[model samples]
Every structure is written in structure tokens, then in C-alpha cells.
Target chain A: MTTPLVSIDNLTVAFPIGRKLFGPPPMVKAVKNVSLSIPKGSFVGLVGESGSGKTTLGRAILQAAPITDGKITYDDGERRYDIASLSKDKLRDFRSQAQLIFQDPYAALSPRMTVRDIIAEPLEVMGLTKTREETDARVREIAAKCRINLEHLRRYPHAFSGGQRQRISIARTLAAGPKFVVADECVAALDVSIQADILNLLKQLQRDLDLTYLFISHDLSVVAHVCDYVAVMYLGEIVEEGPTREIFANPQHDYTKALLAAIPSLDPDQRSRVVSFERGTVTVDG
Target chain B: MSLLSVENLSIRFKTDEGLITTVENVSFDIQEGEVLGLVGESGSGKSVTAKAIMQLNGRNTVYDPASKITLHGGPDIDILSLKRERDMLPIRGGQISMIFQEPMASFAPAITVGKQMVEQLQIHTTMSKAQAKELSIEMLDRVGITEPARRFDQYVFEFSGGMRQRAMIAMALTTKPRLLIADEPTTALDVTIQRQVIDLMKELIGDFGMSILFITHDLGVIAQTADRVAVMYLGRIMEQGAVRDVLRTPAHAYTRGLLNALPNLDNLDAPLTPIPGDIPSPLERPSGCVFHTRNPELAPGSRYETEIPPMSEIRPGHFAALFPEDVQ
Candidate 1:
């Protein structure tokens, strides 16, 4: 259990801004020298703001983004692969082991496809099962685990509400049986009550499936609720990392402390402290 | 004295399915210089009630004859009586300025941010062009936008998300309206930027001393800004009271459900207890107590399902929709 499912060292992801015929093009480094280890079956949280490079780090680990430098090793007991140096054949194999869930449920799924077809598409593409009968069986199993109603599977995406659509999306992601899942703001679009339901479902599935998760979100309270380990990401770098309780109770970095302080407290008698981010005072790396 | 009062407000939209009542028998009043928070989920009809005050609903929308909205500022203006759009002019930007959730959508893409501010002033007041421009720049600077003179000529797309929201605030406050209706102003921004905007609004409220009808679903934001709180369900006001009294000691079951669903930083280990069911669609709206279907406290055949409970005053200012069957 102590073995790291995902190990990274000095990972960097940069995109070229503009093209100039004369000199080398300027580069925007979305992620810079980030190193972290997600232990097997552990829920690791990555927290940051818009320009903080949390999403970039998640994408870089999946090899969806180009890695300019550094090493990424994903090991899920049976298969060991270096994500940065995967060949076409190995890349296909790596994708089956890892998957990602997006933020918007409305746009995530196709309108024309039925819920059963949408969930079955992943397994079919990955060639996880040989026959249509096996695919149907697997889809039904994942749907039940995600708390999706079996009767609703024959209907289209438009028939469901935002929360229901999100459940369908989760069922699709799990169809391929990914050992590592990167849930990027998965529950941000939902209402508070439904958001709780989805969070509980995710926790239960994590236990039942024995999967590892890298949960990326901007909401600190949500991260504190489900994550076992917390990593605080600032601009292109992780400022701090520790157990969720210790990181929240005794944060070392000033940015982490400021983030925790800014959440509006529920008590009306107390004033929720507002630490305005004065952008001019801080320096940025070129 | 109260600055605005809305009584027995009911709004229904004529849809293909039928007439769907979005807001029903909702009533509340806002005192001068006080912020009243309207809290509700997506189908809760909080926004419909806010828009009904300004007559901003669509063509298919219908308001009941019994609904009455009175603005007690400057002159006693019967808002519902102003049938013509032209009659709505004096109240729209003159007395009540409104800011929306999306800052970019509110602004004109082709025009400079400063020009829009000046245009708003011209529509509401008779200030000279030069005077309006000067005032616009000053207001922008007051909202903490650095180099206001420079930012004045810049388009909205050029500004960052936080800065664009600051520009929106600057525009809304330029007319010096007596009341402001802010609908989810900070929902789209990052937490750090959201804090900045909240602080700016608090400082502005202190300086202007105007009433605000703040509408949003986030309880934390409501706790930070509002003085009084009104919790709304499908189409009814479930609870209303002074912020301290209502939030500290919530009476209605729906209000209790909402608070329980939020992630508590103080009690990290406590499980979030969500209300049992979804907000029923308009076609299947409950007849008596709007939230009876989702109320975890009561089961089927309860009295709440048969009768619409009156909003009884539990304390001096706190009120909740409850029946004697449960209160005793």
C-alpha cells in the first residue's frame, strides 16, 4: 500500500506562444519542476487557482500534454510504463490504465448517444472485452457502482439533469477500468446537495474498486473533505504537501494559509476574513 | 423605514407544457442601508422574485394581479403599475442599479469600459460628457483598479476576470443608486479574487449607505455580505430572519438541510447529509408545502402535505412556514 502508484520528478510542460521567423519562440511554462508521489489506493488532492498550473500538472501526468523535460512513471502493480517515453503501442496501453473526468456534464457527453452506448464506448475503444455481450455486462456493472439507475441507461443525455448526467459521465470513465483517475473539478457544476451525493459515491467507488485518484479542484473545503493527502499548488509549483489534517490545521506556506482564511465562514456573527490578492505587489517569473 | 417592499409576489411562465409557477406568494421587505440575502437553489425562484421588482421577466411571463411591489425611496413608486418601459426608466438606473453574475456579458464588447460608464450616467442623469467621464474614472479608481485613466479606454476582453468584475462594480455604482441588486456577483471568480470583490462591496456599502438585495446560493457569501437572510425553496419563502438568528438557529427543515449539505471546515469529519430527493420539476410541483417531498423530517401523509403552513413569527423578526401540528 505504501508503494507509489504515480511518481514524478522535475516535470515541466511548456507551450509556444508565438512564431517568429528570426529568433526562438517565447514559451509559456504551465508547469515547472513539479515532483510528487501518489501512493496506491490513496486519494491525493491538488488545489490551486486559475493561473496556478494544477490542471497542467494533471494533464502532464496523463501524457495528454507535451512534457519538455522530466520523468513520469505510472505503476499499477502489473504494468510499469514511463509515460513520457511511451511508444504508440505503449501509449494505447497506458491510456487504458489512466482516465480523466472533466468539469462540465452538459458538454462532456454526446447528445445523440444513449447512456448505455456512452458508457460502453470506452470499453469498446479500449478493446477491453471481446463480445458485445461482455461489454453490456461490464457497462451494467459500472453503472450500478456509480449509482446510476439501470432503467435510465436506454435514454439520451438530454433526458437527465446536470447531476444525473455527471453520474453517467463517471460511469463511462470507470468502464475501461482505469486504475488511476484524474477528476478535474468533477463536481463543481453541481448544486451543494447533489455535490455531496456525488462525493459520497466517489469515495465508495474508490474503496470498492481499489483505485488511486488525483483530485484537482479550487474549492478548499471540498479538497479537505475527501482527500487523504493535500498538495498546495501555486503558479507552476507546489508550495507545500502533507497529510490533509496537518496541511489544513498547520499550513506552512503563506499562500496556503491565505487560501484557507478566504473561505466565507458559515457563522453570520463572525466576519469572513478577506485577503485580497494584490497582484501588483507580487513578482512573476519570466 | 423600509426602502422597498414586495408582497404576495407570484410569477408564472406560459410554456408549451402549461403555466409553470416559478415563484408563489413570496414576500419580503428591504430596509434602507441594509443588505437582505435571498438564498436558494436553481429551481428555488429567488431570481424570478428579484427580476419581478424591476419588471425584467420575458414576454411569456405573467405576474398575478395580487402581486404588489412598492419602492418607498424618494417617492412611493408602485413598481407593478408602471406598465410602460419608459415609465420604468426613472427606477431602472436612476434609483436601483443592478449587477449580474457574468461581467463580460453585461458589457458591450466593442465599446471602451469608460464609454459605457459615461453612457449609463447620461441615460440616468443630465451630467455633461466631460463631467461623466471624470466621475467614471474616479469611480474606477475607487474600486481599486490601478491606473483608472488607462483602464478606462481598455475593452473588457483586455482585462483579467477579477479586473472585469471590478469594472462591472464601478459601472453599477456610478449612478449612486439608493438600492443595488447583485445576483451571484462572485460565483464565477476564483476564491482570492472573490474575497477582493466581497471586500470592495462591503467598503462601498459603508460609504454609499444603500440597501442591497443580494441573491445567491452560496451560504458563505451570504454570511459575509447580508444583514438579513431569506431562505427560499421551490416557490416559497421557507425561512426569514436577521442573519445571526436564522443562520445560528435555523427553524425550517429545508434551511437545516441546506446547511447540513455544505462542507464544514470546523467539522471536517462530519458527513454531508443532503436532502433526500431532487427539486421536483415545475409540472410535478407539490401542492401544499413546496418542500414536503424532500423534507427528511416528515414522512408521507403528514399534515404538511395537505395544508400550506402560514409563516408564523417564532421570534420578533424571525419567521418560518410551520404548522401548529409540528411547532407544539
Candidate 2:
């Protein structure tokens, strides 16, 4: 088989809690011995409830979180880098190849910057373009692809609605021409109608730009709709991973089954069909 | 007669830009012991309608003179006529109680959970301090918070996210209000926790025999809890009907768009069709049908562009705001 765009082997991320100088500090294992591969140009969804370590696993792959143990490698089919021990220069170069789309669009973009500058900031910071004109051209191309109106490029974030602001955020993430993206709950803050629009945009961009996405979200229905492959995380470990259709049709894990059953059905007459499962919170292990 | 009836309700706010009409000519009734779901996206004024029921809108809010909100039982109080805070006391928490999306915000960080609940019971009823304490613990236990006596003495910060929400619900129900306004109570919770909360609420409603005004953007939650549903957009109700009729066979274009937009588990391969355009800002309110901007079925230069369609009864007790030909 061809080399995957991203590969992980027993990846683990841990955070120290209440450290002391005497002995080893207690460590909370945010991500535990997780292994998965994301193929090129594939939309892979990672879903779980809160405290399930889905976000940490996504960040670990992006080299944004502490890799306490295990291996994570990024291969663009051209160059492969060991994310845990990358040099400063290599890490800087890797930043342009992998990006993140934050959950809260309101907090992600700077309120002071106009839409043009916000999207262009990445190009400038990465020094991807030599001239200002080149940066403007790239920003315009991505903004247009994100379905943002050209006339609204001069307006601040406050002027746009939640849906429009999210589009702006997407344009900014794509400005540097990343091959892999981690969209962390990107549409959670938007309304359902707006969520569909954003999801459609992501799918279209994946095809147009040949991009791979590690979509991390708590909503299962969204994962089932957009993802080609699905991974279910529970308490810092991957309990199940398979094709989206197969996972949704026949879930194996108890946690995955409970989550699927918890989605309130739109059929009012099917109220009695709601499966009653034992409810318990998953606390992070230390 | 319904338990609570709101007729010709219009609310305008004095914003920095100009006079913004947030909720316009909206009308609905909640029968006793029935659940009414108010579904809308952001800026749809669903929360404003709930706040108006409690008279909790800010000082700059101006209610239309024709607006009437009458609570049917117990002397048939005219909610809109209440001017003083003292006059609203009996209705605010006595006959009407509200639970918010963020339980942390509703709860006082400094006060113990039990003390606050007991205080509400004392003010609303003639219960003594000792009696209120016992009832507070009982309510907490009823809502499924384990070790209620221990949890009562602790602050909200000490409780988990789910536990805090349960405490908030317990406190709200202690007054035995005839009507409860649950504003996105489960939005902050995980799916499993949300299911538990929904089940607890269903049990409470059955036991207390109180009406609930369930406000949320999630149609699924509405389907599970609400008997009647009202779809809102840009300060207007696009459709109002029985939940089954609205969800299964939505009549209005906006309502149909919302249902179609949701990613259905049953039809995983179907493409999601989002409503065409962004919900227009209040300052740029459309001249006619408020949803004309986002409605895909509306043709250009149609009467919908110039005239607001009245709510027409498409079926018995199912209403859609549409022109005769616009009905699907």
C-alpha cells in the first residue's frame, strides 16, 4: 500500500499535575497508546464525548501537544518528518503543511483585523509569498473558494454572522496551502443550517485542493455524514475505528452504541424507541 | 383556554444602530402540562420571547401596545401590565421558573447550592427554613444528584458540569411553578449526559404536571420533548404545529430547509441541503416575509417579497405562514 499522509504508532500524550521536585509528578494520560493512519485526501472523523482525549490526539498529530511517549510521523508523499523530534527549522516548515481550524470563530480571528488581513496574515507569517500582491492574490483565491463575498473583505469580524465568520476562519487556515488540517469542532458554535454549509464547504475543498482532514467533533451524526473513515475515542484510547458506514450501521463498542442511541430521533412517535443506557462520566486517568 | 396565551406580541430594542425589532407580531399558546418547543437559530428572538414572558428584557425594550400575555390560572394575570419588580415577583419564580443554558452563570459562586434553593422556596412559599432545607435535599435527590445532602453544602464550582445542571434544575423546580422555561438546558452537556437530563425532565413534567417552554436550536430535542413546535426566523414564526406534523411533513419552506439541513443517521448518504442564504441581520430586516432572504422556494418578484404572509391553517392545528400558492 502507498504511504499514508499521516501515521501514528502507539501515540501517547500526558500532562503533569501538581508537580513537585521530590519524586515523579502525577501525570494525566490525555491520549493513551493510540494508533491510526490517515490516508491522503481522506476526511477521517474522530468522535467522542467530552474528556475523551479526541482533541489531544488531534493536537498530538499536529505537534501542538506534549508527546510523552510513542511515535507520530507526517509524510506528504515527498518528505517525512518525525513530529516528536523535529528541528526548529523543520518544524517551522511543517507549520505551513499542517494547520488547525479552531472551534470558536469569534475567538479564533482577531477582532481588529479586516478579513483580507486576517487571511493574509498566515501567508505573511510563513513568508510563503515574496510580494504583497502575491499574498493578496492567494487570499482572494481562498476567500472566493470559501464562498466569502469579495466586497466584504474590508469588513471586520464583528460585521459578519457566525456562518460567515467561520468561512473567514477556513480561508485563513487554507491560505498557507496546508496539505493536512485538523478542524477541531469547527462547526459546533454555528447553527445547524450553517453547519451543513460549512461541512459542504469542507468536503468541496477536500476535493478541489486534495487535502486531508482529521475532523475532531463530539457530534456523531456529523461524523457519519462527512467522514470516509471513523474512529471512536473513549477515555484517551481508541475503542473502535472503521469505515463510517460500517461503524454507523454496526457499532461494536458499548460506548459507541450508547452514543448512537443517545441522539434524539426526529420522529416524535418513536419516543419509546430511545434506548435506555447506563449513563456514566468518563474521567481522565492519571 | 390555554394555560398561558401570548397575542400580537412585538418587541423592539433601542440599539446603537437604530430601533431593532427583535420579535414581531408573534403569537402562541402553551396549554397546561404541555411542552411547547420554540426552535430557531441565532437572532431568531426565541429567547426574547421567553424573557418577555418573565418580563426579564432590558430597560430599552419596548413592547407593542397591542401585545397581551395572560396567564390563565390563578386570577388570570396580565403579564404585560406588570410594571414594578415587586408586582412581577409572584409570577417570576412563584408561578413561572426558568433554567438557563449555562448553569454556572445562573448559580452564585459564593453561595452553597442548598442555601440558594432553600431561599427560593422560602420566598415563593411560606415554608420555614428547616422545611425548605429538607425539601431542597429531596429535590436534589429527585434530580439524580448522588449524595444530595453532601452536595447541598458544596458550591457550584465543586460539582461536575452535569451535576451543576442537575442542581440548577432541582432549584428551579423547588418552587412548584406551573410553567417552566428551559432555555437550552442540555446544550452544554455531552450526548449521554444530555439524554439523562432529558429523561429526568420528562419524569419531572409527569410528576409536577407543569407546562414547559423548551427553547433550543436542536430539532431532535424538540421532537423528543415538545408536543407542539414553532419554527422561528428573523423575529417571526415561520411555522407552528404539532411536532409530528412539523417534523414528518413540514409545510413551510424554511421549516423544510431546517429539517433537510440536519444530517440524518437513517439517510447517511443523502446530501444535506442548507437553507440558501444567511439569516438577515435585524437592521436589514426584509420588507415582507422575514425568511424571504434564505428561502429557496421563493421566486423573485413574488408577492412574498412585498407582503408578509399570514399564518394559514394547512391542516387542523397545523399553521404555516405562507401565501396560498406557496404552500407545499
Candidate 3:
């Protein structure tokens, strides 16, 4: 097919545990040799339990995490940047194009700043807008797109609820006009009803802005619902990746099957249907 | 007779802003050996209701005079009437024990897991330290902790997330409480671990013949563990009924919205329809029905906006807080 927006080839990220005088210093490989591709304007989900290295891979794609090996290429069909060897100036330019939406809305936003200032901070930091008026206009435009009322712009994050605060965070992420966003567990903290609202907002924003999203979450039902493609991470390795429908319908990996069965079903009659796996059976691969 | 009965329960907290009503006129009952699930969002006051049963709210909490909680195993005891903390000791951990969402917070960091469990047993029962230790080891092994003897001497930090939660469960059940309050115990667990915990709880419930008040925001967990379910919204019970009836045919508009909002595996292509509008802040609670603001079925200026609907019986045992005329 055509060129993908972001392509990862055998990416690896490792952290040294401690200082060593002789031999090799023991290192923990967070993201093992794994390769994946994200089509332009598609919502790709990377799902794994804790310590599965999903978060590290997401950070590596944005060049926020150290790339110990392999390559990551980002292309918007305009300019392609090899993220591993970007210069200071080029990395700054890339920052505006790649953004991150954090999980905890409470901790992500600055409590001291008004909603207006929080959204405008990204634009100001990147020097994307020229004047104060231009910054305000851009902020308001993205705020309106995110469904945040203009009246609430003067209020601090403390005044907003969890769902409203998340909308403000999304507005800030989009204010930078990023082509790709890594929403790491962005909707995990929200109530189910509120989660649907945020998911719909993200999907709507993708259509309106033609944005590519790396939706990182541990909730399988959520990934099945929103993501166009799904990748399963197990112990720093991608055990499975395919279209969401295909993966959900016929999971090839044992870990993927276990995860799907582990989800508590809403139907009361299905209570006895859960497939049980022995403890420590799904531990990380060496 | 029911194991526990809460009648006309109303709870308010004296905050700096004003007296905020967190739970209003809520009432429910749990039979012996029954599991009743209390389901709601963050501000729906499910946690407050659970805490009120244990009398565990902060100092600012004010309970209405009409509120009554009765525990009926031995002599019918009025739980709310026990004004002193010492008088409520037997009910708190002896008759009723609680496990929280965060096991780390509940566990003592400096002490060994076995010490805490034995200490609790000594306080509640006439068990010697040696006997308590033996019982604690057995309990740990029952909860599926490997190397129970070694784990008994370890601190909470030494245990994994799932193991810690299991240890908390083991500690809570060590006393063989008549009623257990599990406030989102599985919410913090991974899905696989959650499955294990849920299975363990079911097995323990059967073995001990104890009732449980399972509070959580997830309907899936409620469906699996609860015999009965109560749906709350903004400090009010919107629906109460058998789990099967509630899940199969939800009567309340808010209940319907909640079920619709969930991403079901049965229909992957179905669009998720969130309940409209954010849950109104407790400070600015609506004038009439608590869920009217976000309920899509209610028209603007409808009677539901001005008058509170009583819990009307739709099925034999299923009740929905809606006008009789509203029921289809």
C-alpha cells in the first residue's frame, strides 16, 4: 500500500539497572525488538497489562523515550523525519506535529492557569502563533472543536469535573495542530458514560482534523470499539497485530485470548463462561 | 430476616461551601448470604452509602434523625444509634468488614501481613496469638498466595499488586464477618487478576455463607457477582432489582443510558451513546429528578424536571424511580 504515517522497525528500549565494574551491566529491556505500522488517519490501539512496555513504545514513537536500537520514521506525505537522529531545531519542529495526551486529567493540567491559558500554552511554547490575538483565536477554535464552551475558558481546572478537564486536555493537544497524538490511557480514568463521550470526541476530531492517533489503553472492549487496528503487547514484544475486527473475532495469540476472556461480561448468564488460566502462565518472555 | 437493613438513609457533609447532600432517602436490604451490588459513578454517593453502613465517614458527615441501619444476626442492633466509636467496634470489623480499592492504603507498611491479621483476630475473637498465626497462614493459603509461610512474614511492599489485594481479602475474611463491604475491590486490578479475585470472592461467599455489599462503577463486575443490583445517580437510587431483570430489561432512563454507554462485545459495530451532558455537580444538584439533566428521554420542562418520582414497581421485585405513567 501507500506509505504509512509512522513506521517502527525492530524498536528496542532498555534501561541499565545499576553500575557495574566488570562484565555487562544488567539492563531491563522495556520494549523488545518489535515492529509496527500506523496508517495515516487511523486509530491504532496498543494494549497490554502493566510492564508490557506499551507506554515506552508510545513514547519512543514521539522520540520522548530513548531509542536503544532500530528506527522510527514519521511521514505526513510531506516531510519524513527519522526520529532517532533529529537535530535540535528539527526536533522542536517535530514537537508541534507529535503530541501526547496524558491519562490523569487532574495531574495533566496546570491548576493555576485558566482553561484558556492552558490551551494557549502549547501554541505559545512552540511559537506557532505570532501575536496574542492569533493565539487566542487558535485556542478558541480548538476549544470549540473539542466541545468546551467559551464561557468556561476563564475557569481553572479545579472548577471542571473529570470529563470536562479531559476535554480541556484534548483541546490543548489539538491546539498545537499535531498530526499524530499518543493518547495514553486518556479515557481509562473516566466513568463509562463519560468515556464514550471522550471516545466520540476523539473520533470526531480525527475526522475533522485528519489526525492519526496511537490510542494506548488496557481496556480491550474500548479498543475493540474505537480502534481501527489493534496490537497486543506481551512482555515488551508484539505478539499479535491486525485489524480490530479480525483480532477480536479470531485471536491467534494465547495472551490475547486470555485477555479477551478475562473481560467481565455484562450478561449475567455468561458468568460461567470465563476461561481460567493458571497463575504465572502469562509471564514476560525473556 | 434480612442480614442488614437501611431505612430512609440520608447523609450530608458540612463543607466550606455549604451542607451538601451526598445520599438522600436511600434504602436497601441484604439478605443472609446474598450479594447486593451498589453501582454508580464517582459522585453518585455509592461509596458514601457503603461507608455509612460502617459509620466510616469523616467528622463533617451528618446523618439525618430519620436514618436507621439495623443489623439482625443476634440481638437486633441499631447500627446508627451507637454514637461512640468503641461501641461500634464489634460491628465494624467483627460483624462487618471492609476491603477498599487500593490494597496498599488498607495494609500497614511497617508490619508483617501475618501480624496484622493475627492482631485483628485477637481483637475480635478469643484467639491466642499462636492460634491466630496458624489461622492466618491457612487463610493466606486459601486465598491462593504461594509459599504462605514465607509470605506471612513479608511486608505489603514485597507482594505484587494482585497478591496484595488477595492478602487484603484474606485479612478481611479472616474474622468470618457476617456482612462484607467491598468498595471497588477489583477496580484497581488487571483484568486477569480481577477475574481471579472475583472467583475467589464467589468461592469464599459460598464457604462462609456471608452477605456482601459490592460497590463499583462497572456493571460487568456487578453482573457476575451480584444477586441483586441497585443503580444510583447523583445521590439517588434510580433503580433496584434482581441482576437478571435489571440487566435484561432496565426500566430507568439512566439505567438504560448506562447500559447503552458500555461497549459490549456482543455488538462491536453498535455506536456508543453516552448519556447527554456531564453529571451535574453535587453543589448544583437539580431541582427534581437527579438524572433529569443528563437523561435523553426526558423532554425539556417535562414533569420529571419539577417533581421527584417515587420508586414504582414495574416487575414483582424490580423497582424504578419513575412515574407509573413513564413505564412502558
Kindly report, for each predicted structure in the order presented, the TM-score of its chain A compared with the true chain A.
0.96, 0.96, 0.95
lDDT of 3 by residue, B149-263 (tens): 9999999999988999999999999998999999999999889888889999999999999999999999999999999999998889999999999999999989999999999
Worst ten in a row by lDDT for model 1 chain B: B319-328
Please list all clashing residue pairs in model 2, or write none if there are none.
none
TM-score of model 1 relative to the true fold? 0.97
lDDT of 2 at A133: 91
Global lDDT scores for all candidate models? 0.90, 0.92, 0.93
Root-mean-square deviation of every model = 1.8, 1.5, 1.6
Q: What is the interface RMSD of candidate 3, in Å?
A: 0.7
For residues B110-140, write the lDDT of model 1, one tens digit per residue: 9999999999899998999999999999999
State the DockQ of every prediction.
0.75, 0.84, 0.85
Please give the lDDT score at residue B128 for candidate 3.
93
User: What TM-score, to 2 decimals, does candidate 3 have?
Assistant: 0.98
Considering just the first chain, candidate 3 attains a TM-score of 0.95
